[model samples]
Target: TATGWAQGGIAAAIGADDAPSLHAADTEAAGAGLTDPAVALRVAAEGPRLIDWLVSLGAPFDRDADGALALGLEAAHGRRRIVRAGGDSTGGRVLETLVRAVFATPSIEVVTASVHDLLQDENGAAAGVVCERDGARFRIRARAVVLATGGVGALYASTTNPRGATGRGLALAARAGAVMRDLEFVQFHPTAIAVGADPMPLATEALRGEGARLVDETGAAVMAGIAGGDLAPRDVVARGIFQALARGRTVYLDTRGALGASMPTRFPTVAGLCATAGIDPARQAIPVRPAAHYHMGGIRVDGTCASSVPGLYANGEVASTGLHGANRLASNSLLEALAFSGFIADAFDAMPPAAVLPEIRTARASSDLPAIRAIMERHVGVVRDAAGLQIAVDGLSRLAETGCDAALTALMMAQAALGRCESRGGHWRSDHPHAAPARHTEATLRSPGAAPSEPARTDEALAR
Candidate 1:
């Protein structure tokens, strides 16, 4: 579960001095002008209630000395509005809480299997899914299908996401003729622990909020000439670290001066991770580098979490609701998922009965992941240029023709990155280096390996 790997807490305006509007302002500021104000406001207003809902399910969130919820701070947030659990083990604890609640419910059944494809009715609406479990293929027909399969960080060689984060849901949506929006906006965390590990360990952004610094060898500040120094928006910090590494400088997250001896209790997750890498935060600066962390782009969905496909829905990292826009605000990922879950439920309940499911055979081909990862890491990484992006699009297109879902998703991402022709938020183009007009990128697959001629653009928020 990628949620279990999240060390930062959920952002919510629960403080007495804070309001949802203030929270929305900070979100919009971090979003680089693409975040929908209404979406931000609605999600912000849902924060306190969502926290309450989690508490009712025994989430065991951390509390201050007064027994109220302990609120921490993160980058780009103006207030101490991050609600956490067990210090830095918020995601693990929350996952445990939800699992317990889910098991307690009688209507749910937990299945361990891989969904290979979606089944559609005669009218082209989603109706079911094809599943494979223990070497046996089967089908489970349903009225609707909701994809929550997470982000595409695993497409890159260096990432903090689990290996399974390969954009499975995005591929599923695209193959079903659903719109994908801003597939280029991949967020790279500036502080992935660089100790020669695959799927690198993350040093949460909250560490910087607690006064950590980004320094290179000889204690030179890596972000010295940059605005906001070590506490800038994620994209700025990532570029700083990336450019520093490109110049043969070894970057480090100097937490020795910040948390130090209190690291174990304050951030035991990162402390334990550092120990495995043979680093002692109390005595040494932690070596770090930028790595793919999250995706602000996904299947285009409306306010109700409904996709262009009539009976297909999306939530969490799988759906683009125009909240994150060009970049996602720190700690807002978990909050967005929580707020949208209710909207998805309401949409599902009001839907008409599903049409008869048509019998459709589905098959999946093994992907050459090493080849795909190498292309993405070299061409479409933290920094991008037209020549490299064109190379990526060409390479990925050939793999997509082989019926590789991972490759199709990567090709879409590369196409979107190439078409944008400007640096904005997560999609930085070294050739362009500056943003043009602000507009959302919309695309859909007409056929496998077929690229859109030009991406559609809209300056306003996606339709509600």
Candidate 2:
């Protein structure tokens, strides 16, 4: 589910003690200097109303006894204004409510299947998706297709996303001639529990907000600016953890002094992980390391969540709405998804139904999936340089050389990542670590055997 691993609560300027401008400023700061100020301002301004709407929909946000909203502070926030539900289980709770609403509505159909490839009509516009369900292949045709398939955290050996977040939507859009952006900005959380889990449990930023400290094996503060440490933006914190690992220092998060008596009630998710790892948070420091968490870049979309392809829509982590910019603020992923889902739904509802979608069956067969996974994890995983990115591009191109449509998606990701020369947000590179003055570029070329040309990266093209 899209909401299972969300540990931090939603960031909003809903608290009386806070204002929207402060929130927007923090957002731009976290986005690594590439955040669109207009988008930041708009989302921040509308956050309170969105939160109220979610509350009305039975989101169960924690509220004070007097009926005021109970807010919690996370990293990068200038105030204690995060809206939470069931403590750290905000994502799960929100997902539960949304799933129920989706199931109850006759307008939405919940299908349990993985989309194998996109189906296109004679005119070359995306018409439907080829999905594999219950070991049988089928096609679901719609006038508009919205991809909320989530992120690529699973491609790494360690992640905090669902197993399906293998950049499936990213590849799908690229192969369909949709414009992609910011493919290089992959965010790595600095405080993932290093328990060797495939998707490591997250040590939420709330722990630091509650006064947790990052220390080494000797219980010494390894990070500078101790008082203002953990609240540093994700990039600084992730790089700090990387440095500690480079020096062979065992990194640990000291929550005993901060979480205190509220461990079980306030953050059940973190408590459960600690119990499973056999580490008592009240008594000992938890082992921690940085791991891939979210993708800042994705299939490019406009305000309406439509992609470059007509009738194709993308939402959630799959769509790059220019909101997160280079880096995403903590807990904003869920908010962005919720806000845009409506944008996509509304746009799709207003469009007419497709008269006759393509019925041509795909001839491609699945093979070497494991090899493709290995290649992505090896070169395109985390740190990247020009040579490594080029190698990844070549490798993905060869995958397309096999004539599999799925491989084209991977090739597009590699090609886009290779073209981005500067580091921004999650897209860090030793070769290009500084932001350069450059106009935004969209990767609109499709995978092999598809369309070709330099499609414009305009809002109109994204809305299709």
Candidate 3:
């Protein structure tokens, strides 16, 4: 669902002068030294192949006059290698293509339900899942389980992600003993349309790539004194706008000088979002602010996309594959997912089945999500200090102890943020005010379930 809502195009190295090495270099630079060089190179190389595969599956990409793929540009990239479809609606098109492929595949069956617990063997290897549908629980047996549930943006009071993006998969994984990494680095997009919407609508960075500018109330550039100006990597741009707002200034994204009347045709999705917000981009500046957009950290996965626990794997925003380190390069999330999916499939095919199996029914804990969101937005947000992080850690940890899934996930993020004392990439600490030696923050659930729980009717089979 997050993939379908994504508006930025995919990044690739298919231009005449472009190379995978160059694209990898750009990605490493943006990641601030935490990105794995080998991972970056390999993922970048797979970009063109994945795009071609999508096309073969009937994805209609925008093309130039000569019939080649029309590549656009985004910030922090040295070349124009962003591949889009239906203008700024690349994600929706890609999702539609994948859905058609899945529907035609007789081997794959789709089930809609809320997965709450992991079924593991006596040896502690993942075996299957326990799902709840219509208030009744069922156990689905499988050799392996892979999670692609997406990021934790909805944990923030203001975000561009759907409400369900609350990191439920993360809670499930953490409880199952998955090692999490870099939980501190959450990317905040600098231009989420501020129209008092519950989940804010995003104004894609591609608009700035196409010549839009960030300006304040008096028409003065908001990012004038910032390096890279309006086109900085997401973190820098977000901090720039955040500091301006902290100083009592209103920030806006002005597209009048750029796309103007052509916006409807060039960026149909954003134009429609603007129309809903009662904004006319051709005549008025779009009111904007930084809001949670992506998570650069997640369940740590190996090169094969397998987690620390056997028989369990992750993909998409739920897995941290070392491709996105401190900060993710623009338009790389979708490409990374496409590339790693192949590795996940290969890993599962070669994995030995667990000899023992068991069933576990879990009753999820409820929490005051509003209170948790307020704590995160007030403390662990765009900028942080030791005191604020401490407050966040204490507050979330309390709720986490009660087995509240949302609070447990938020607690993991807060604990990571609190441990890192330096400012780097997306985790900017106003107190530290400078970058330190780059390192990752990792976490694992120390107790059984963050809290104890009782199920209505429990049935479990244990295997050796």
Candidate 3 C-alpha error for residue 8, in Å: 0.6
Residue pairs with backbone overlap in model 2: 185-427
Candidate 3 residues 55-129, lDDT tens each? 999999999999999999899998999999989999999999999999999999999998888888877778888
Candidate 1 lDDT over 122-147, as tens digits, reads 77788888899999988888888889
Candidate 2, residues 199-308, lDDT tens digits: the string is: 78898888888888899998888677643487887877887788788789999999885474578888888999989999889888999988878887888888898888
- Provide the global lDDT of candidate 1 against the true structure: 0.87
Off by over 4 Å in 3: 448-464
A best-first ranking of the candidates according to their lDDT comes to 3, 1, 2
In candidate 3, residue 358 scores what lDDT? 62
> What's the true lDDT of residue 177 in model 3?
78
How accurate locally, in lDDT, is each candidate? 0.87, 0.75, 0.88
Please give the TM-score that candidate 2 achieves against the real structure: 0.90
The stretch of ten residues in a row with the least summed lDDT in candidate 3 is 455-464
Q: How many residue pairs clash in each candidate?
A: 0, 1, 0
